[model samples]
Target chain A: MTHKRVLSLTLNGKNRQDLVPDNMLLVEYLREVTGNTGTKQGCDGGECGACTVLIDGEPHLSCITLAATVEGRKIETIESLAVNGRMSALQRAFHEKLGTQCGYCTPGMIMASEALLRTEKKPSKDTIRTALGGNICRCTGYVKIIEAVETAAEEVAS
Target chain B: MTEVLPEFRVVRPATAQEAAAAHRDNEGARYLAGGTDLIPNVRRGIGDPDLLIDLGGIADLKKIEVGANGARIGAGVTLAHLAKNAQIAAAYPAVITAAKSIAGPGHRAAGTVGGNVCLDTRCVFYNQSQWWRESNNFCLKYKGDTCHVAPKSTYCHAAYSGDLAPVLLVMGAQVEVTGPEGSRTIALPDLYGEDGQNYLALKRGEFVTAVLLPKDVLPTVYEKMRVRGAIDFPLAGVAVALRRDGDKIGDLKVAVTGTNSRPFIVEGIEELVGGPLSDEVLDKIGDLVQKQVSPMRTTLVAPFGRRRIAAALARRQASALFAG
Candidate 1:
């Protein structure tokens, strides 16, 4: 028997609906059905934050969340963080500060940092580290990522 | 045998009753909440259920409310949600502290308290991949009768590693589980048995719906010991509840986790209620707790390291209790 369920979700800024299997993870649905493959999946388990996305502007692991569970909720992926072909100040700082190398952890890292910045415009270094704790970057050793967030805070404040 | 991973149908029910009915209908089916624990087991093929009933959509389980009676924490409330909740932070700071230390923020957001409390007692042998288990000839925790950790023993030696269990035990929390039969409240302490494999005493097909924490017990603190700061399960954790009458200790409850198959309430601490909480008295209590816990080399760290931390956690929790 097919166990398909209807999910109504707001992805980025667009409202979308799809019928998917009951067990389909949100990350898979975004990659397969919605054709948004930018959100990478490192560890299907919640350990690596490669699947991190913003649920109601808060950082959440998309890989662990069920597609059906996000019904009627707003979700923001890395694709939405930028505005109209212009990188957000955070994105600019990430590039300038060399926040990424292999780029696998970029989406999740950007989403987590964006979530943190939304609430705290000028967060401390510790707050930025805690926000990005779930995201694992094997390259660059997170020095640049942390600096990028710090620079982003200053850029936004200025 | 072919390496094809078994696939299953997933059912999402809107209500608890509907979920229970689904559970009753499906053979070899398990209820899925956060999937922080279940998915990993499924990935390892240790959990081969024919059906997975996703309860994340169930309305009743997502609630977090406090009334005149007490706080009713819904089973689906994520650890991150509980950790950040203002009321929970104020009323039971120990629980918040415990929840915060459970995993990193993303896991905390995805991992529910219900999943954490109902976490399957784990042994290193049982938690390993099927291929790994085959190499070692299996263990008592899985299908085999031989306990790899303690070969002569009849039971499994999986450690109870949940960060929330000890805190809830010390706070005198009760779990309300809804099953095919009906609903029942098991005292947090009674919910877990010492046997690692068959750790939970809750009836078959029963799912924990809510946890009831009683009001106005005493000031409490949860101390968890781990190698790293976050994500790692407690090597050893302690929850201490203390009440002081004037200068003398009125009551004390010490609960220990991660060192045994189930969390244990340290007995004989009641005797220390009337005495002062001196360094000597705390040390004596620590010794008593050290005697009660029997840690194993089942999880991330060594057994001796776990045992040593159990006593240290007890002392730290006791100090926190007495300080406030």
Candidate 2:
């Protein structure tokens, strides 16, 4: 096997370094090595978005991402959605609107929504639904998730 | 869990030369890009190469520039970037629309245009997990001798699954590939072999670097039919690029996706040029397209349905692109 390489990353605003095999997926590295279990591995394939994370402020599927590729890159996992123990406005809205059911896909859904809101700030319901379309939610039918994003937009607006 | 899965060396090469050298150094090595296609195939235990040369760290492969002669899209440029690129949106709107229709936001953010073009030919039988393949006694693509899609046929019949390929082909794009020797550019249509298994003509250890669009070509239209509006590979996609001289069709290029082995260019539709694009002419052209395209049942949609949709979408896009 090829020797493992040290990958330095700025994860959720903290500088971290870990030795990762080239085969180690970013999602696995995040959950297993960094102990950031918030990045769930749903499909182990690119089909599911449960392992979504933000790389350079853009949402990406972590399951398909090689951990070695993110060296020196800024990564934002679901854990960073909160600041100083206070949930981000989107998280509060997700809870307030009861947006989650099984909670498996929330992290990815929230990350995708966060990316969308960071750009649009106020998106239509259809746009929110389209934005989160890649992250499948077998639970809750996603009505409340769209509602949660809309509610969060309103909260941020007010 | 009983047996140890084979673990191979992993190499992360930061530059083109390093990546090429790493690939040449190992016998069972494969370049890894966005992995929207490769990672899933590996997890499914299909063609699991021993060494994965991660090309994602190579910075030079991620540039997207619009020059005097159309656009140059780097292989590592993500689908999300292509979908949102202003130059692509304005100059090559068909490609932008196709890229936007690829997957949801997250996967799009990770799926690169190069990965999409080099997507493994997909068949329902071929895409299953190893255990599932063991149960079914694998097909012509990976294991057994017989074709799964067509038992009587001699070769694999996996569907061409990329959404952007047809659009780019219609735009008359050329792809550049780099390897140990050097880089070479070829028309995208010339990049695929006729057979599904040997679809790509890329050399071993060679990586697709970029795609170059023609300068000041005709406007294009892309129409795709799938089960869902988004996050679904095309059941059948038709891309038509045409130049209009007043009301006559001047130059026409039609490429169809999700059919057969490689995306086929409809060079057969040149008979109607210089003639009035009347309803009857369009109908004849669609009929010719239907006769030429040989879509099979491997696609998610019905084979006949895909053929008919291909004809209809071709007619629609032709008229849409050519009509003033």
Candidate 3:
């Protein structure tokens, strides 16, 4: 469709600009243009959360979202979680807790956990479960993932 | 991962009138809302539109105003916002109930109420990849002559599985539509058509601008039957709004979806208008609704199962509303 324009947005705290097609998905734009391959595309149909990203600090499915629709907005991906080769508390907790089996859903799980922790200083197990309900893990049964998030919450609080 | 979208041009208009004007200029133009449904339909080669009018950026279409009369929700209001609005939650919890029931938190963040109200009906035989559909010979909903779900049927039988429309209709909501012609408001139920092939009765280049929900002090509930709790379309769903007069029913509206070609306002609600919802009475009403619903083989659930669940779900929701 006709609205091919110069799409500009803040990506991971950096100003980025690109000419994108009207039908380009946000996930594809992030991976291809921005080179953030950490966001996996498990199901391009939006059934899976592997393509989840924080649009203005809100969890959104990038696979189904059009890049042109989110123009001039702040986007945070899994790549933004770590800084200067040092893992964030949640990432370290995931590593310490071994919250992955096939390692596909880790990025989405961590992103969701990051959002939850930012809003709720200390989220209960049920609150954590409800918040991460959108991000599915096919390999691990989410037991360790939940524990990892809980541990990260404690670590960040302390 | 591109789903192989058809080549189309996008137009982002700042106002509803501008959006409508864009549609007036371009032929075969479609309004792009959240793209949760339209984008996928495009990937499957459903309706080919050369120009798309993007309504996501229009600021005027995203307002949520609650006044003495009722609430006026901009069509562009995201489903996630609706689920989180505290005042709206207290007054119209069923709207949130229906909103949260759809897909997951991520999809809900991207999905919009207008998109759900105008969502395309779905059928297992129709919603597939282009190649997958090609092998099976396309159904009437897309590019074929006959509907595979009901081969002998004259009209398409795609199931209307959206959760919001039935709830909106039950709440006596009115919709404001801006189109190539002009802006006009109509009842929510009037927006639908009987045939799935031409489900929405929207005029060409017309898009829903906002939903006007009248003040409803009555108790309401929405119950949906989906395969998974997190992310799946409804197999069958029921929405009920009730006003009780002491021990008798004062006024009630029961609507159902995910059962037939279009989400329909249950007929024979007059029976429940004045009677008490006793066990025997509710049991009979449930059975009668199932019979009147006449579930078809267009959705994931079997016809018999959907037929049985439709009324039971409605009764359960009704009872819950009363109990609460």
For each candidate, report its DockQ versus the true two-chain complex: 0.44, 0.55, 0.62
Arrange candidates by lDDT, descending. Answer: 3, 1, 2
* Candidate 3 chain B, poorest ten consecutive residues by summed lDDT: B1-10
Model 1's alpha-carbon lDDT is 0.84
lDDT minimum window of 10 residues, candidate 2 chain B: B1-10
lDDT of 2 at B294: 76
Ranking by DockQ: 3, 2, 1
- Give the TM-scores of the predictions, in the order they appear: 0.94, 0.95, 0.96
Residues B184-285 of candidate 2: C-alpha lDDT, one tens digit per residue: 999999888667787899988888989899877678888888887667778888888887888787878788888768887886677777776779878987
Question: Highest DockQ, which number?
Answer: 3
Off by over 4 Å in 2: A1-3, B1-6
Alpha-carbon RMSD, each predicted model: 2.4, 2.2, 1.8
> Mind giving the per-residue lDDT tens digits that candidate 3 earns over B1-324?
345667787778999999989988888898888888877778677777888788988998888888899999999999988888887888888898898888877878888889988888888888788878888888877778888987898888888888998888888899999998899999988999888889988888899999999985467788988777777888888988888888888878888988876788888776877888788768866876787776677766688998888988988877776665
Q: Which whole-number lDDT from 0 to 100 does residue B149 have in model 2?
A: 82
Candidate 1, B1-324: lDDT as tens digits: 112234677777888888888988888999888887777677666778888888878888988997777799999998878888998887888888888888777787778988999888777788767788878888888768799889989888898888888888888899999998889898998899989988999777899999999876578888887776666677888888888877788889999888899988888888888988898998898889888999887876778787778888888877776777
Top candidate, metric TM-score: 3
Report lDDT (CA) for all predictions.
Answer: 0.84, 0.83, 0.85
Off by over 4 Å in 3: A1-4
Winning candidate number (lDDT) = 3
